[model samples]
Target chain A: MVNEQGYNVALVGATGAVGHKMLETLERKKFPIKQLTLLSSSRSAGKKINFKGEEYTVQEATPESFEGIQIALFSAGGSVSKSLAHEAVARGAVVIDNTSAFRMDENVPLVVPEVNEEDIAKHNGIIANPNCSTIQMVAALKPIQAKFGMSRVIVSTYQAVSGAGNLAIDELKDQSQAFLNGEDMEANLLPVSGDKKHYPIAFNALPQIDVFQENGYTYEEMKMINETKKIMHAPGLPVAATCVRLPFFTSHAESVYVEVADENVTVKDIQSALVNADGIILEDDPSTQTYPTPLSASGKSEVFVGRVRKDLDNAKGFHLWVVSDNLLKGAAWNSVQIAESLIKNNWL
Target chain B: MVNEQGYNVALVGATGAVGHKMLETLERKKFPIKQLTLLSSSRSAGKKINFKGEEYTVQEATPESFEGIQIALFSAGGSVSKSLAHEAVARGAVVIDNTSAFRMDENVPLVVPEVNEEDIAKHNGIIANPNCSTIQMVAALKPIQAKFGMSRVIVSTYQAVSGAGNLAIDELKDQSQAFLNGEDMEANLLPVSGDKKHYPIAFNALPQIDVFQENGYTYEEMKMINETKKIMHAPGLPVAATCVRLPFFTSHAESVYVEVADENVTVKDIQSALVNADGIILEDDPSTQTYPTPLSASGKSEVFVGRVRKDLDNAKGFHLWVVSDNLLKGAAWNSVQIAESLIKNNWL
Candidate 1:
């Protein structure tokens, strides 16, 4: 149904944080489209968004809204995607879901183009975008694993507040202002929006990124662990994660430790492997004091890898620092990239 | 020389961050002080400080300053401690140095009061206080290690800018205001004050805590690794650390992973050991969404431990979240605690 004039595209939840980024990304990449439909929940249905110098009003999404749509990009909440994504698929539109609704579904393919582009073809109707933290780590580690082979991985993340959405971002801003003015600040959303207790993230670090699971691991940490396994196709790989939320507004940085399979693998080997990999930029030079900080990698689509070093004790052990804009390569950009992959492969 | 009445005590770098904390700790602990002599470099000299409703003027420290001083606390720069610690020891004072200069000296005891207070008697003249990050971790891990016998330890730190100095604290505040006001943030003293190419730490996380060493690890990381070995008296224990500076004003939090010697060790056993250990607080209960955060643990002397769990893959492997006031248990309080132990045990 897609022609050279472009596909009939629909953007669902086009008013949320990641959804706004999706619109910008789609416009910046100049993805072809004969028609662009903006859809949202009833609350944001009347909102107007500008795309490619054209004004579009966001309409309330319904099953019939996808009558002639060829591609639908979803960034709404999980329930929205859970209730509406299959309806879009039933109408012959391919859905690229940005929520956790279908990410782990056996029939749905969890895709990170850099790590598993081939998985896109096997999707039944809905293609799942991996978690933001998981996408960045797997993208940075894919090249290393391909070159040296990884057996074990341990990661500790310094995540930003934007991953929790726009409300969390406003909380950080208002809290920071109040903190600076020596006034009391309120915390209604943060660490986990749905969790019982809320904590201030103005000048502090919260170890919990999401609601706790029965296993004592936060949902965010468990997502990083499980999604990494699925994307890497390494179910038996030993992976552990400690996810923490910092005060930054954008980008997530991680301290990753990996044990490679080969004994002769060096940091230089890993660096060289990642330097030329697609969607990864290497910024490591200890002598020059060059490594990626969250601010330095805040507004780009590439996953930055740095601080590569060999462990002193374990011969096969290596350490890496990975950084990327949580909203870009982690969410919006990755989703757009999957859409591009779908078009290039004619999967839609 | 040591009587029930009091003893002559000298406080070096009285105007600096840790030195100020040392003064406060000594005052709070009601340490017996017959005459208090405040010493600093020529730059900070002549400043007046109040102790017990009396004012004491800081004087430029010289070799003669320690002639009758019973206990000398040094927290100036490393070179200052290197230049004057032994001079104080040579005269009649027992030096409790808070700089890295003497921490690694074979004759010096790097003491964490809760971990190894008995080592105080082994000090020739100088007892070195461990680094702020190292002190908190070792204090929390000592009880667990004592009970289970640790085999390997790995730690990643969420350290505060206050650990850098008072100037870094100002920098964080100013830069934060500038960032919120949409102005440029200047970074002159961060990551490492002496290191070149400063980066903004107002709302960011810097992975390089101190200057990079020859092995690519920062001096801060190396200090944590080396100091932990010396304090734990386990030279053969495999330990690794990644030190990062966050945007907090006090307290340092660590994500520690340890492999114990005993296979039957459980999280409950680890919690029991830390709950009863002196200077350790256990705040772990995932069911209740309770865990120790940096802000919650700020200004506290005890090392707060939480998020205790056994690793999914390794039965003997356990994870702990450790937090404490970097200026208190990490430096000033630990130094004063050592002095207290010395008095109680009649070692001085």
Candidate 2:
């Protein structure tokens, strides 16, 4: 698979936060490509990106943006991906979408490669990236699910502002400064910027991350609920997420409580599985005060897991604290990994 | 009862983080203090602290230090509290100890007055201040517990580094600066100051807040677990906690999941209970993106409660976020309130 001929790769929305990381991941992972095309919105069309020390000019993405591209990576907002992803797919490109646009489409494979690489082969051109919160949970849970058969997942996330895009990061910084200076903070871009009210995140927690869906779960919440079922291949999995935006600028951290079918699985067994799992770094030495945090996971590509232990009274239940950089493994790198997978499997 | 003749108050660890706040709380609340004695490890002796602009010199804490001290407030490290608390108690001083040393001591009442004021009468001259994480949680859950019996509690905290002490706060600033400049960081405090290794908290989370306990729960976790039972007076209640230290300088936030004994207790009902609970402020309104945050709770006496919502599948379960300045409500003010309680209840 590593010796396979490289496919022609293209990056759509190549100038955004996750988009920039996509470039970094592609280069860092040594994702092969005979040729590369950079595409973005009209406003950023003329921007040039330097990858592997080669400058590439960005062109406005349209229906024809995928002309010779064999594989396309998308991290644009949902709207852009929804409008142009099909166009890229129609142009003979296997599109790996890093948006919620088509995750629950039922036609797409929601992949975290490590959790479900085989599912990626079933993709009908467009593969979806699971929610950042969901990605970390699944990456950490897949090993357990494979060995122990998990039944239910209850995750309450302390998500960073980066998952909302770069604007939220700026807002956090600006508001934090205002707070320290005794000035009135303008919370224009947090807890759903379009939502009527804004709460300060400098030292606050916003329960709602994205807009609420019809089922009362916020769009961010629904993504985790639906995507977990798709990635784990358990359609009826009872998954509940309470996602809150904290003051951090990067990395989404989760406190996941899971009920496993195997009651005999001890904490040592869970620790071994997590430590052996791909893309997971277990930092759970309680004696050394070792565990994950958003600040430490920032810019790292692996899902940092810690605080793994058995529930106090429940024999079949366990708890874990998982953290990962939303920009890297959550979106950009995961999207790029899918592109690399398609090339390795000769699907591109 | 509040129309009180003042009580004699002694502040142990008179020059530390919580000690300073205790002074502010006493002055701000105008706690009925007829006499004040300042005690610390002999090092802080001779140091002068001003309360309401009145000068008080710190004294060495020994058995003789509590000669006439009535209500003694202890926030020096656990060792100091452990050694001198019983000494003070022998001198007829009711010691409100802000340390982990006596929290689990069966005879010592772990009190959060709003939640378990009646438990105070059972104290054997030694009262324990719950962990900062547990303090805010019990404050928010007290009203909920009153309206509906709480069956189980699962909490993950986004705690401020200040909860570790004043030194960790300075370390955060220094490390953050070092990190921003692409420089290596030195850690003298954090996670656990006495631990062998120190990781940078510039953008990292250390799952350990204190020493590891025998049950595999960190001292911080055990504190939350045991203190919850003591404060809520629910011996049979199930409680679990994963305490995380964040980069924030002040305020500790928690994502708490609770399964109530009562059925169908709606989010609105929980909100209504928190709306008027003493030392609580309800700020949960999803449509308006309103919720409680640490910044808003900072500098305020009341714990801020928000993100109150019913669980999707479990009708009897609910989730709530609680935030408060760890120094204020969690330690200093709570200790001061204990002093006020002594005067109000005529216990001194």
Candidate 3:
């Protein structure tokens, strides 16, 4: 239930992709707001963004932008978040950042409320939203982790273009047109927009999601590895990831292989736990050909898992197919959910 | 490495996709053949197929087609293989069938030369080439299993349209053209051409492949499950699979999660072993964005694996991203390789 004492909320990076979705999510959830501030870089600052038929001009996010803000949602680039998120937090606003800037920080509570809602209370005016791919996986695996105590997880992701940014969505449209016309696929946006030497993703698959780290794992892969442990509160848990950028537009799908600690854990038990798991939709019926696909999960906030099965000989081994809209559960809805959790737990 | 006195050879279903590829393979490998017979169904009978500048007319495959045929390669539908394979075997002709009819017959040997070439001598007139996804995987994993002793395997596959045969390929082309013109997706072939509903795969992923089995795993999934056991000669090994059909024209990619018996194994050890393994090409240099992709692996016979890594805390577990040409390693070359193994070992 929303209170009459509404707070002033600001959306940083208001004109961007995830920011636009955040605007929609706030309205759809009927989030209480005494005032709304839309902030972006100077180039996009003056543009007017419409939310619930109410037009708000985007203002440059400076140190003073959050003076009267009680809550702030940041989906701007990591550089922008690093620059101004502290200002917003210091001005007495609870900041939920949707970038990699603060996700791995020891003090910041990296959250997917369905998995780590209580951790929200420990945040010192800032909460880190996990990576799009990591968020969906943890949300789906959390229930199973609670029931069976996950020992190890191996995931290969089929991520969408939107996770990269608005430029990537435009690149997908442009490259797709070139591919259909039998022209050369021009790629300047992904697997990393800032990284050198890009490859065509229109009719191809890229095994790299982010720039490679020194240890051989892409930053995106490390995010999944590190964030899985953070969100599930299992620091020593075994997690490995191979993140690939597919030609898909929005939703992300993962092929997850896990080994539970319990020797008696059957696939049925995992399915039952997932069916009752919060914020997760179990689509495990195989007879009618029911399973999760990225297209089906597009724009939805729920994590969809299917194709859950046990290994022929190992009673503790299992596999799952998990999918969720990266724009939703991966970003906007998750940020908004954390905001709600903060308010409910009296931490806002 | 070369032999001159090879047995007489015949190709059943010589007008089909795999059959044409088989013909190309046989010519490329220059298999020693005293006589060559091309046999097809009644509909394709009298149709001539070209191989390396030679033309051979396809005759109706009947019980009598086996006369004096020392070894026959059958890629006909399961019904045709079931109906005529026994007849051919009774005529003193050994057969290598590429249909699901005899894969699980308990008497048939499902062979991927890199994995189970020794099982060829035990074949009761027939050896089976596994499903496209399973063949490549077993080829990559066999060496690892031999060195490490695997206890569990969980795989999620990204399969191609060509696995469904030529008609589906035509349908994909037609629908892609239609979708580009802003016309309806007009699905008729994918997910399952035999199923009532169809979905567009041009910019999408379909989570179902083959018809659904009673247990909910698609026939394709079951094929991987059963064929992995047969090829790896590990019927009691734990294996689970989720088969998905992507829009690619060739090659199949799998995210394989495996648990080895040795708990202290590292990702380095796995990579070194795979580099030295037969039929496996290690393409896992993440620094330069080097990994096997379907587009890169298309038309290639080797099982290409990349994104190999050990689970964070589980010393016994590892993940591999395996890719290969479904047409080559999965079917044509494997079939031809079996024939070559036969002559080399004097098993024919």
Best by lDDT: 1
Q: What are the runs in model 2 whose C-alpha is more than 4 Å off?
A: A1-5, A169-188, A191-193, A196-206, A212-217, A295-299, B1-5
lDDT of 1 at A331: 93
RMSD of each: 1.1, 2.5, 2.8
Point out the worst 10-residue segment of candidate 1 chain A by lDDT. Answer: A1-10
By DockQ, the candidates rank as: 1, 3, 2
Candidate 2 chain B: worst-modelled 10 consecutive residues by lDDT: B1-10
TM-score of 2: 0.94
For each candidate, how many residue pairs have backbone atoms clashing (under 3 Å)? 0, 7, 1
Please give the interface root mean square deviation for model 1, in Å: 0.9
| lDDT for each residue of candidate 2 in B1-348, tens digit (9 for 90 to 100) | 553567678888888888888888888887777888888998889998998878888889889989888888999988998898989999999999999898889998888888887777777799888888888899998888888888889888888888888788789777766655568988877778888877777556667778887666788888888888878888889898888787778888888889888786888788888887998888766665566676667888889887776777688888787889999999998877776676667665
Q: After superposition, how far is residue B318 of candidate 3 from its true place, in Å?
A: 2.4
Candidate 2 C-alpha lDDT tens digits along A182-291: 68888887887787777777646667788876554688877888788888999888887888787778898888999899889999999999989999999888766677
Which model, 1 or 3, shows the larger lDDT? 1
Docking class of 3: acceptable
Please list the residue runs of candidate 3 whose C-alpha ends up more than 4 Å from where it truly belongs after superposition.
A1-5, A46-48, A54-56, A260-269, B1-8, B32-36, B45-48, B54-57, B178-183, B261-266
Give fnat for candidates 1, 2 and onward, in order.
0.56, 0.45, 0.46
Tens digit of lDDT per residue, candidate 1, span B24-70?
Answer: 99989999988999999999899999988998899999999999998
Give every collision pair in model 3.
A313-B238
TM-score of chain A of each: 0.98, 0.96, 0.98
Interface DockQ of candidate 3: 0.47
